[model samples]
Target: MTEYLLYYWPGIPGRGEYVRLVLAEGGADWIDVEREGAPDGEPALSDILSDTSRHHLPFAPPFLKHGEVVLAQTALICDYLGGRLSLAPEGKKDRRFALQLALTIADLVAEAHDIHHPVAAALYYEDQKQAAARAAETFRDTRIPKFLGYFEQVLKANPDSQDWLVGETRSHADLALAHTVDGLTYALPNAMEAALEDHRRVRDLSRRVRALPAIAEYLDSDRRQAFSEHGIFRHYPELDA
Candidate 1:
């Protein structure tokens, strides 16, 4: 069995957490490259990403290397790992459904990040504080509810009805949603508290994912990274409702 190598930024969970959950649950033999401090730090991550030799180059971090294949993008990496690790939904239809769900979850994650960096990714939150506040208000009022409501309805509409987001079994999408929920709660506690109440199914799904055996252990382990200012989801009291 070829051990998987995950290339993600050090410290914060970010998009890598989504892929980490799958690897943890599946008991995959994987190594978190930069986190372990082997070759170097962010430089190694950047070099691998900019490597011109590879025809299929990934645009960013959170990419997974399996043998010669380098898969990037949180959604794509999660989907690829899910299937290989037996964490994916069975059959052609469910597989596509899970992928779509993961993609949708990614959209929500991006929006959550934009709340703090509404103007530009390069500018610090301090420079864009005023803009972030305005953007966050709309995000809390409209986007949060819309995305959470969609996930809630999706769970209710799932034919499996076994608490998983996609099919009966837990898939990459479910894991990703759980991670997103944790981030949202950390970043916008006030908004998430009210939204979670209205979205019980989604809440339960996130809880269920957290309660999984491997995940429970992983959460308590040193490997599990906490939510902070650097990650996609960030807490700025002024931005929250």
Candidate 2:
């Protein structure tokens, strides 16, 4: 059994949370390298990202290292893990559909993050408060509805079951959707409340994901990081309607 090593920021649940959820649910033998400090005292995440010798260098955090393969991008990592952990559908088409849905959720996550840092990721939210407010308005009004509504339709159209996104069994895409909804609920309570009113299936899916045995335990454990200003989903009152 190859042990998985996940490299992510220590505090705040960002893109890494998506990968963590899948690993936890699958009961994979994995270590959060950064969370569990290295002997050198150097930040594990920075060490991996800054390593010039690696042929495939990730430009950011939330990368997974399994044996010699170091994979980047949240959705891509999830897709890879989905295959290894049986969190993906059996057939090729279903697996591809699952990846498609996961990527869509990733897009939504990026948009949500952009709401607070409209000007640039490097710039502080306080510096771009006015721009953030405007960006947030568009996100709450147009983007949330568009993405959430699509998920609702996907659930309805699922030939096997209405609960899971791809097939009868829970996939990585479902976890990603659940996490995205959790973030939205945390950051934009009022906006999410309105958006979910018409999305009963999506709401139910989120509830189901939260109720999973491993997921429930993980959520209650110390490993589950809290939402904060430093994370992708920041609960700024001004940014939220």
lDDT of 2 by residue, 1-241 (tens): 4378899888889999999999999989887888875434333777777788878999888899887788999999999999999898999999999999999999899999999988999988889999999999999999999999999999999999978999889999999999999999999999999888979899999999999999999999988999988999889987776
Q: Which candidate number maximizes lDDT? A: 2
The residue pairs found clashing in candidate 2 are none
Clashes of each: 0, 0
In the range 4-115, model 1's lDDT, one tens digit per residue, is 8888988999999999999999999877888775332333567777678878888888888887788898998988999999988988999998999999999999999998
Candidate 2: residue 200 Cα off by (Å) = 0.8
TM-score list, all predictions: 0.95, 0.95
Total backbone clashes of candidate 2, pairs 3 or more residues apart or in separate chains: 0
How big is the positional error of residue 135 in model 2, measured in Å on the Cα after superposition?
Answer: 0.8
lDDT of 2 at 144: 91
Q: Which ten residues in a row have the lowest lDDT in candidate 2?
A: 36-45
